[model samples]
Target: MQRRRLLQSAALALCPAACEKKRRSPLPFATLADLTSMIQAEQTTPLLLVEHFLERIAQIDRSGPRVNSILELNPEAKTIATTCKPGLLHGLPVLIKDNIETADAMQTTAGSLALRGHKPKRDAALVTRLREAGAVILGKTNLSEWANIRSPNSTSGWSARGGLTRNPHRLTHSASGSSSGSAAAVAAGLAPAAIGTETNGSIVSPASACGIVGFKPTVGLINGAGIIPITHHQDTAGPLTLTVRDAELLMQVLAENFTATPLPDILIGARLGVLRTQSGKHPQVLALFEATLQKLRDAGTIIVDLVELPNAREAGALAWKALLIELRADLNAYLEQRGGDVRSLAELIAFNEQHRDTEMPHFGQEFFAQAEQLGTPEIIAAGQEARKLAMQLAGPEGIDAALKAHDLDALICPTNDPVGLIDLKSGDTNERVASTPAAVAGYPHLTVPMGFVDGLPVGFSFIGTANDDAHILALGHHFEQLTQARRAPAFSAG
Candidate 1:
């Protein structure tokens, strides 16, 4: 027995390299760039990548940790992979947020039961762009119902159709919203990356909470034709990825009038301003911010402290008012064109009331009801004016003014507070987040994992003026390289 045990131990010791060949290809937490390289080098085929991810979705997303990030997987993904030609994305499998329409076997319900089985006749412009770039549509991810516009008191990751998407880092924590599933899936290594939309903090907040990179580009930069609407002024889809470089690559494929610009190789002498007002009230987050600032300083960055945006409070309030007013009109338009039985905001409200047991069990649709009440033509005109003023305040007088005044390239702040507890009774308890100014202004916002606090992740943000997507991405890439702070989630049962 002793001789047999010794022989077995020796065999196990020699099996690492041999056994590794039989293990999963591409490894866990592989970035999109890494996958692209593997595909280009013929190290892995597209079908293999799809199969591997499908298996992971079964193991990690569905069963093991039960992150429940995906709403539906593409039944045709493997076949699509086998036929996909070499291009920018080149057989990569990418997940789409449910709000974005894809004309496929999978449904795009935006997490609302009313829109169940609602598949579009044509792909959303961004989905078309992904297809053109040789990406296989892997699946649709769950989201906050109606992109969290259904209720002012809604729990962010909970949907009547998809249930709740838990944070991969800690099961008890909130995944933020409405891009919760997209962010969680990327952080959990279910896919190389996922696409998410942001009306306010939908992309960045969830990305920060899940410890990944989320980039919200200028609103109109990517075509917004087929996405379910909140407000056209504030709504845009962006990439959530494990690295800023992957975000950049996805943006290159998604953006219209694509232009490639050379980015700086290093962060030395890079000038940045700190947005103190939007920085959260969490002490630990603030400490992490300070430590990150010192790291930047040590890396030869010029940090300008405490730059305040003018009329930030007023801008946010006006933006909210505008969103409420626009919601009814924009959503009505989308619903009508979408050719669904629930074809209007009023009808949608009624649909929810009829299905209250499923849809309204946890929270009421106060925002939708409020928006339905404000359907007067006069209110819509007022909303347009408010949108104009908000853009001026948050864009020219806000982010741009601060940058020009300080002669800085961009603004930096904490992306969000640490992950809050998942509370269905009280709904989301998110504190101050740095996504507002950029979100309202339709500028570029990039969040990269900064560090952890008490086993939860926080992100450092880079906010820049309109059409400054490339510069913001470059800045975030530099910070990511310098700090290397992003760690894969352990799926702890906290």
Candidate 2:
């Protein structure tokens, strides 16, 4: 087994006195294990943790940087934490994305104004499972309205209910999306960890841009019964935290049967496919990626370089078509059960039009209009075919094919370019993102902090086949141990 290496860097060691104190405090930016140990040793109670987080949310999130990551907090969080039964996550606080149902005093608006007062009669299955695991539902984080499916040119992290979520690294940069708030909140030390759902790049991208750990488990590994839909084919909630082990703990709780055994030597003799095609255009990103490649080589891992996925553009088009159709059908189903003020996609569109002053001030609902028009049987059939083709292309013909051909245990690529400038006037400025293949294939993808560029952080992704969630987590954990790539956000405020 390869011995662990510590990254003894000046930046890491030169933490401010306040940060050092925070790191040692009752509610530090800590790992799940650290918190659990404190609780187990009777050093702190779950109620104390909840109150600490709630106070931090009030100080940093609502007043200081005005990160705007949270939409609402559960008033009964302390009560729930106090009376919770012991389980894996006992007494932990996890922030749920605004898109997920909580069935509490909070509303599951999915960041849409139309669902401002919508409340489900029952909690989402995942929420119920989390509660059973002793997790205190901390509150809801803001997100891109309708999970950023409302328009092609919409700004990420900008929901009508929750204005804009600023990156803690730099107040003006984008937090990515549609899991924007979840990632931002975690990065800003507003929560120990948060749950973020992804359809394509939603989870990993934000986690990547925000400089944290994001794990998108094999689709269907975690129950998606309560999450607001983007595409049932690609939606799954995962954890965003300071460390990969925290993500593993969360995955265990979320995927009830999950238990991770340490891989004695995760890197020795392992073969990893380097998806060069998906690396971003940014020069700094390329440099960081190359440095990462060198680290892997030094660790005795074989790198199969310059690999490409076939039919990339065509598969993307198909995925888009499928998303529209699935959004229409899946959303309608969710609304039927949700019994919201707006019952259908058509009503949602009309509502946006009616509230153009607030909702449409930034971008129009073009994607929603398309979804409204995509209800015909012919369109539905075409969408199903497209989804199948996209899945085949992204799965067997794409990621799976290359993995088999190269004898790779996992795949690596830049998760996204460095954080972009948040521009509401022209909408989100996206860069090269490596999420589509695993997303459409319904596989597991994990993004870990890689390095920084121009003071902003970027991440590298480790992707594996459908049931390889544990393997990916092990790889990420090993890599993190070797590099210690994650840097605490500066919380640069306006």
Candidate 3:
């Protein structure tokens, strides 16, 4: 067991008056057990603990890596702390992907300068559950501008309002979007945990970029209300955390239907599919994926490597098109309710045109143009065809048919390549990942840390059908316990 070491340098000790108060430990950060114990002992109130996190937010976020991934900070965090209890998460602080909303003072910018001042009128239903579970809604983290669907050239974590989010590993690599900020913050210890939504690989890809466990629940598991629009079929909020227990902790809060437990030996022995076709990730990542298969096989898992996924890329493209069309309608309706200004996507594009200095300094809204064209009858039919093909390729004919044909508990793949260079003008050029297929199916996928490459972390994704989220989470938990694959990075004291 990695005995959670406490590194209490003078730097960590440079806390606000809140963290500087008398304490047995001088450190600014604590482990999962440490946090749970602190809450259990009442040694520190949830309010004070949240204050510590906010202090860290002021200290490290955007200051160090200039990892400008956070779109906004929740101003009503203190107010949320006042209503805490013990049965639920009990005041653990968490970051929300910018696309999701809380009725806090923070503006939900979705990483675009166009909607800079839009405030969600009320908590998204999932935010309601987060509060009910006693978790502190810390703030909104930055994401790919429009969740990376706006433009293929869009930088993963570079938002006009938030700037570019730096990778925790090298400080120069891309933190894969569109859930870029959510993954970076949790890995950097900016928060104990965070929430992220996915239309494609948004959740798991970023989680892979910054070493953390990311869970995208079976579609509809977490309510999508108040989340800035994407494809409703695919988008849902899930947990990104340092440990499987923490991932389970957040999932329990978000879903009305899930219970966490380590799977039994018989369950571990269940057939597992080793996807052989995903050849896009790095060599180290492929090695890690193979290593993971070896671990499971050694434990008696019936590993099947010959499984086929002919529809993977085609389905992925379809899912992207579906997202664009859905985003147009969903966003326009969301904007209509706001009603005071910005009423349509056209207006938003116009606003960005007016402020192109901030929003388009690096890349143009080519995806927005693509989306704007989707509403036309010609493009609409093409979108319909894409949706049908996607459903056929990724859903019943792809992951489902393959998993069933092989009789597998879950399917594994390299989620994302290790950290790549951050390019604000060109965006993430070395991008490659395997989160698209499962994401398109609206199935649940859990990404646990696989291993590190060049001192950078990569992850393996375990994806399963919608309602079987618990099974995948349990399998991931087992792997996490067996391998324990994570190491905190040290700040370069140059």
The prediction achieving the highest lDDT against the true structure is: 1
Q: Pick the candidate with the highest TM-score.
A: 1
Per-residue CA lDDT of model 3 for 1-494, tens digit only, reads: 11211332342367645445524331343655568777677566676677777777777775755556566777788777767655567777778888776777888768777666667788888888887777788888988877776667777887777777767666778778888888888887788788888877888888887888888888888778888877777777888888877788777778877887655664456777877786464677777777877887787778788678767878888777777887777778888886646888888888888988877888888777767766877776777788778877898889898888878888877777776677776666856777778778888989988888777788878888768887888888778877788767544221
Q: Rank the candidates by TM-score, best first.
A: 1, 2, 3
Clashes of 2: 0
* Model 1: ten consecutive residues of lowest lDDT: 16-25
Error of 3 at 112 (Å): 2.5
* Candidate achieving higher TM-score, 1 or 2: 1
lDDT of 1 at 253: 95
- lDDT of candidates 1 onward, in order: 0.90, 0.87, 0.76
Q: What tens-digit string does per-residue lDDT give for candidate 2 at 1-494?
A: 01211231342377556434543467558677888888897666786788788888989889977888998999899788778879989998899999888888998888878887768787888899889999999999999888888898999999998889989888889999999999999998888999999998899989988999999998899998888898889999889999999999888888856778699778888899888777767888999888988998999989989877666667788998899999999988888778867888888888889999988898999988888899999999999999999988888888888888888999899898876788999998877678888898899999999999888889989999888999999999999998898877887753
Least accurate 10 contiguous residues by lDDT in model 3: 1-10
**TM-score of every candidate relative to the true structure:** 0.95, 0.94, 0.90
Taking the tens digit of each residue's C-alpha lDDT, what string does model 1 give over 1-494? Answer: 45654774585589866434433567768888898887777667787788889999999988999999999999999779878766899899999999999998999899998987666889999999999899999999999999999887889999999999999999999999999999999999999999999999999999999999999999999999999999999999999999999999999999996565666755789899998888867899999999999999999999999898888889999999899999888999999999877999999999999999999999999989899999888898898999999999999998899999999989999998887899999999865668888988999999999999999989999999999889889889989999999998989998
Q: Which run of 10 residues does model 2 get worst, by summed lDDT?
A: 1-10
